[model samples]
Target: MLNIMELQQILPQEYPFLLIDRVLELDEGKRIVAIKNVTANEHFFVGHFPGLPVMPGVLILEAMAQTAIVLYAKTKHVDKNMVRYYFAKAEIKFKAPVVPGDVLQIEVEAEKMLSTGGILKAVASVEGKTVAESVIGFSVKNIREDKT
Candidate 1:
C-alpha cells in the first residue's frame, strides 16, 4: 500500500492533475489496484458540467495509466524521476458515469510486457460496479536533462 506522499514521489503529476489518491495493492510485473476519490471541488467538475458534473473519460484513462506506471517502474527497477512514461494507446469503453463523492477504484493487470514498456488491461469501478475499462499501452524512455 502506497500513501499519497509515496504516490507523489512516483508520479510526475501534482494537485488537480494527480488522479490516483492511493495504491491498495501492487504486484511487481503483474498488476496494481488504486483509487481516486472524486469530489465536487475537483477543478474539472466546474466546467465538465456546471450542474451535472461527471468525471471526464480522458482523466479516467489517465488514472489507469498512472497506476500502470507504478507497476512498470517497480517491475523494471527504473527511477521514475529519470524516465518519462508515455500513454501510447488505449482501447477503452465507458459503461457508466463517475460522479462526485464516488470512490473510483482502478485496477490494472499486465497483458504483455515489452522491452520499452508494456500493454495493460485496466478497469475503473464505483461501489463494485465497473464504470470504465480499457486495454492501455505505455512506453518509458529516459529523460535527458541538459548536463552541459
Candidate 2:
C-alpha cells in the first residue's frame, strides 16, 4: 500500500486534482487497486451541489485514469517526473452516483500496450458494487526538460 507522500513521489497531480488516496494493491504492469475517500469537505461538493452533493462522474473516471497511469509508469519503469502519461481516450459508463462519505475503490487492469500508448480496463466500486467502469487509454511521452 502507498500513502499520500509516496503517491506524491510517483504521481504528478497535487491537491484537489490528486484523487486516489492510496494504492491498496499493485501488480506492476498488470493491474492495480486504489482508494478514494470521498468526503463532504471536498471542494467540489460546494459547487457540485449544495443540498445534495454528489461526486461528479468525470472525476470518478479521472481517478480511475490516474490509477491506470501509475500502472503504466510502473510497468515501463519510467520516472513520473521524466515521463508524462496523458489521458488519450476513454469509453466510460456511470452506473451510480458517488456521494459524500462514500469509500470509492478503483481497480485498473492493463488490457494491451502499443508503441505509443496502452489500453486499460478500470472499474470503480463502493461496498463491492461497481459504480463506474471504463476502457481507458493513455499515451506516454518523455518530457523535454527545459534548461533554464
| CA lDDT of every candidate | 0.90, 0.88
Candidate 1 Cα deviation (angstroms), residue 127: 0.7
Q: What is the C-alpha local distance difference test score of candidate 1?
A: 0.90
Question: Please, what are the lDDT tens digits per residue for candidate 2 over residues 19-94?
Answer: 9999999998789999999998998999898899999898999899889877777677678788777777899989
Separately for all candidates shown, the number of backbone clashes (residues 3 or more apart, or on different chains) is 0, 0
TM-score for each predicted model, relative to the true structure: 0.94, 0.93
Best by TM-score: 1
Residue-wise C-alpha lDDT for candidate 1, range 1-148, written one tens digit per residue: 9999998888888887999999999998899999999988999998998889999999999999999888888788778678887787999999999999999999999998875889999999999999999999887777884232
TM-score, candidate number 1: 0.94
After superposition of all CA atoms, the RMSD between model 1 and the true structure is 2.3
